[model samples]
Target chain A: MNRKGKLWIIILLDIVLGLVFFKALIGASEELSWVYIEKGGIRPDDILSYLDRKDYGTVAIMARSYRIGSKVRDEDEELYLMGEYADLLFYERIFAEDGQTEEAADFEKRRGEIRGVIPEYESVLDDMDQGIEKGLHGVTSDE
Target chain B: MKCPNCGAEVELLDEVCPYCGAVNKESAAHRAEMKHYKERSKNAKEKACGIISENVALIVSSVVLVLLVIGIVAATYVEKNAFMFSHWAARSESLQKSAEYAGILRQYLDSGDYAAFLAFENAHVIPAYEEGYTEFEKISGMATNYVAAMNSIENVVLFGEGAKHYSVDTDISSCQRSIANFFYTYERALTDMEGDPHYGKLLDMKGKMDVALRIYLGLDEEKREEYLESSEGRQKAYLEEVLALE
Candidate 1:
């Protein structure tokens, strides 16, 4: 097998521990829920920040609801890919290294726009409300 | 001039059929070219058809070959795991059950209702301590074999989905068996206690057995009864497929 295949087999090995027990028990197919640290060193705080700024309205509010939980959720299997913002930073850095300045700058700018909108605490909610309105209207707000 | 003058029956020298003045040469030449074009079109289509047919055959054969390989791999994986499961079934569950019960007895010895501790006394704890020391002797003896089964060529091939299912069934059952065996020994020791001072230890072992047995046989009563009845060496029937003997 190729390197990628070998890596996948290793992952499959770990997953088997969970699956084997379930299969062995036959009728007792209970699933255990786990909170795992995400790969690529993407801190929970960083993910929460991204979630908050990525959307407005009830969607953003839902993000807020999950933010307080000590556990972090990752949709993708966080196998050994390396990067900050977890794995994404690796790709982003690659973009920068290839001297794709314009693309990288645009990428960082959009990211900054998200960081700009999502305030840290509820104390800034009044200001965020205006930002949300601006976002919904598809206009830039001086506020 | 001759064609214009002739009103009937004209030769080629007269330019056209005298019955009707027409461009005979031009019409005949056009028919020749049209015939040639149609023949060429047919040949071209057949050549293209031949190319497409060849490619289609190549693609279909490749797909069939790939599927065949995958089928072989899948079948091998399943067979190996099934064999392993059967092997696990052949062994009695008692060994594993004992180890686990011992671990629990150790725990309750360390913690739980304090009155529960003195109950173990010299009579109860000593035998369990000795049995716990030796209970995994079978599995321990099989350790090399287990490792071989996990690491050898046959076992290596039995990995992925197959490995997962095989290991899980055997691994959990092994744990249950080890634990159950330990508890049974302890329970047996408790029975030997004919007098007082050991009452508390007896109750401790009893309570621990109640919880552990319920778990070992499964949480439900029906399942527990089924396990107790169908255990290996018993004639009671089992729902699982009978594994092939070595």
Candidate 2:
């Protein structure tokens, strides 16, 4: 092949490698971010700062959902969603309502409804207990 | 071309500079010379391509190696935190409920209203405490297993390979300790109440319970007569005696 042809091929190959490298880096970063979020590493203060800045809304939500959902039960998608919703609304109510107002009353009513629908605190504890039991068995089997 | 030593133009075919007596090293046929330089340039470009293509595999391998390293790091991070995260989340959920229950008991304890306290104990506090104690027992049992699981994981994996030094031991032990402390505190409260001069209030609670039970059972005069003949009536008669002492 001609020199120009070979050079073009090399350039094309380099571009592909660069793209792969970047994609891998991004994927790794996103994975780690989720891990951090799941571990309760993202504090309320971390998100409150973004709320203050009025930026990274999506980021804040992602962090909040993972942080709260972890408490609900990671394997149960339904419970996780419900927990996330409850958490978000709890903060929303705090930020949006003033005392002795209709809005506050409405928020309380909604809060009660959410609490009613979500699994009871006792059940959540039971699920955690069961999960830990299973984990222990898994570890035993692995050993 | 210009003469090497003098400002004079010469024909491309000239082998020597007629004006300066300088040998015309550049006197090769102009078309041929151009062709030669173009060919050399082509050779250089090909050499460049050769070098790039030769190292292409190496470059790709290096990139892949880096990616592998990154993947391992991400995997290690997730592995380390995933279990601990769930562990802590469970602990937090349990702790929140336990704290709330403890707070309620504390409030009642602080009120110092003997009648109200007796009523609440009969109606809510005692049952809730029993339920809580049972739940804590189950929780502590599971926590023991969880600690074992965590230790198992720690044993197999290299140090620092997973979540950064999770003291699963400390975490689970603390939970167990809290449950123990809670149970002890409640037991101590009951003991103190029994020993206090206010023990009469505790006895009076039985009479309150009989009344509450009668009301709850909707005992009309006829049913009341039937109940008075039953085992529950016997218990109530005993409670009446205690209530008389109070």
Candidate 3:
């Protein structure tokens, strides 16, 4: 092969390997985050309002459980990911609203991207509720 | 007609037939042929030995590969089943707790201490439900962690149907669904009772409670005992299995 062709082959290999490594890293981070949450990393404020915080820890965990249980497909997975992403952006919004310049600009640019996916997440949640209802029916049917 | 030293046609007059001068020419030719055959045989034996020596590494490698495959399969089975067994332990523990609380409520009703029963219902029973609800959430959270870990482990661990243990996934999901339903039903009943202090909400709550208790009680005394006993055993065995793997 000519020098240019060899260079192209090397570049292609590099890109493939890079993607594989990045994916692995993402998978690891997600796993670690989940483990942390399960082991009591979730707080009441994560899911419930203070006035209704009779069982805040439980509510928070249940919310996450519903989110996870509702996930059944690649699109659902993406929606879950985007929900987490939106949470980060929402935090940025908090800071941005406090007049952090770079965060303000980035928040303005990206908040809409997260906002766009909220309806889809809500739809996924509806599907999950339906699934639970179906399950309940099944249990009752056995009786 | 032949001389001893060399084959000769003249029997008595000549000592040798001198085609090529040698004594006992027939025997000498036989010896020469035998020596040639021995040299060739030695060369063939050495070649065979060389081939066998060269293949030693290849043979060892093939055996190692087969053993490695078996080890991987065993590890996958153990890991997936261990996870499932851990979930089973958690579920059993939760069920036992629910059953215990239900038993107490049943006892209260049977004893006809309506005031005490109501107080218990308000103070302890409702809080227990809240705890159970939260516990289920934690279990589901762990399952989410499992799912994520499964994804990462799949990249490293080949032959993993760990990700496809859909039965355990369904089991946990079903538990959450049941908990949610019970919480909603029971909570609504309580709310109605608070609003009206009537028998209707009381009956509704009791009905729901009865259904739950019956399911747990239906296992018969012996089976329930066995399940309770086996849960501990399974947990211990599961831990040992995990340690063995490590």
Candidate 4:
């Protein structure tokens, strides 16, 4: 081809490649934004945040909501289960302290049922029980 | 034409006349014209080569730019699907360790820790549909619904505790939806497990799930049997009553 013809072809290719590059960059940016920004919704740790504040009621509901929202994976399974178990035990104590025997019994029975399912975690349960008895702090708190 | 000196016949391009040994006058002019034409042709050929060489560089650079753009796009695609690729890769690896996974899965099931079983299965990306793991399929399926039901009921019990943080009507509706979904899935699972070899294990899970419902949602054995035998509308009413939504 002549010089002019070759130049025009190169210009055409440049336009096409530029558009493709622009599109790819846009898509990548959108994906990155979603992964970093919009994906930052509730996490299981959010439940623990309420626990840190000693908001047992909020912690209980948040833990349950988190469990229903996310799947149980082995990495987080113990945390999830223990979070719920601690919430149950916490409420059981509160109800008993208030002399609401029936309500307290219900909570006790619920925790027992949970214990029945995860019988192998006796040591963890023992720790949780001790933690609850020690002034009702967070489930995993060393204090 | 004839030679100028001897008037003998000679070619225009000849410098000498063969017949009379004389010089040809037209020979020098003819050679000069040929030389001028050759020079012009050489100049034209060199000009063309220069243009092509310049454009070849342009073309090569453009191709490199195009390749670079494609590479960037491909890298983005792989990045976006990194989780999917990793999950698939892990599943392939798990397929090779089917016996080991099956043993672990059996241990979870035998221990009545359906939640752990599910967690292990999912975390390892076990190939549940493969031949070696197919035996656990029915049980796992049931276990999924059972676990979901258990969680949903727990949500029902806990929602009241956190009423200050949520809208009562919306949370109630959400909990009701979860319960209805569980019952629907539970019914389907029962049908699927009718003749399954894992039916006994499923029954045991169902028993535990029943106890949970009783303790949390206050649905006793008779109430649960009635709920199962009732129609869809009655089931809804029963849930509302049991949940104290009335």
Which candidate tops TM-score? 4
Q: Supply DockQ values for each candidate.
A: 0.01, 0.03, 0.02, 0.09
Q: What is the lDDT of candidate 2?
A: 0.41
> In candidate 3, how many Å is residue A31 off?
11
lDDT of 3 at B206: 41
Off-target runs (Cα >4 Å) in candidate 1 are A1-143, B1-110, B113-166, B196-199, B213-217, B221-226, B233-246
lDDT per residue (tens digit) for residues A74-116 in model 2: 4444434333333333222222321223543554464456456
- Preferred candidate (DockQ higher): 1 or 2: 2
Worst 10 residues of 3 chain B by lDDT: B153-162
- What lDDT tens digits, residue by residue, belong to model 1 across residues B115-223? 1122222112223324443432222222222222111111111111111222434433443444345445545555554353334544543443333233212223465
Per-candidate iRMSD:
28.6, 21.3, 20.7, 10.0
* lDDT of candidate 3 over B1-246, digit per residue (tens): 455554555333223355545444435555677789999999999999897686665555555555555555554454435434444444455455765655554554443222223333332323333553432232222223222322221111111111222233333334333433444444554554454323343443344333322232222334333433454445334323321211
The per-model lDDT (C-alpha) reads 0.34, 0.41, 0.37, 0.60
Predicted candidate 4 versus true structure: per-residue lDDT over B1-246, tens digit per residue: 878888878887777888887767678898789889999999999999987787786777578677867767785795586556556665786798898889888876765556557656765677677978998888887777766555545444433222233343543555556556666776787788788767777766665665555554545667666766776667556555555521
Give the lowest summed-lDDT range of ten residues in model 1 chain B: B154-163
Residues B51-106, candidate 2, lDDT per residue (tens digit)? 97887766665666666666656555655556454445444554456556445544
For residues A7-82, write the lDDT of model 4, one tens digit per residue.
6777777777777777776776545433322122335576555444433434444444223233444554555565
Native-referenced DockQ of model 3:
0.02
Chain A TM-score of prediction number 3: 0.28
What does the lDDT read for residue B70 in candidate 1?
A: 56
| TM-score of B-chain for each predicted structure, in order | 0.26, 0.22, 0.19, 0.59
What is the TM-score (0 to 1) of candidate 4? 0.49
Candidate 3, after superposition: displacement of residue A85 in Å?
A: 4.6
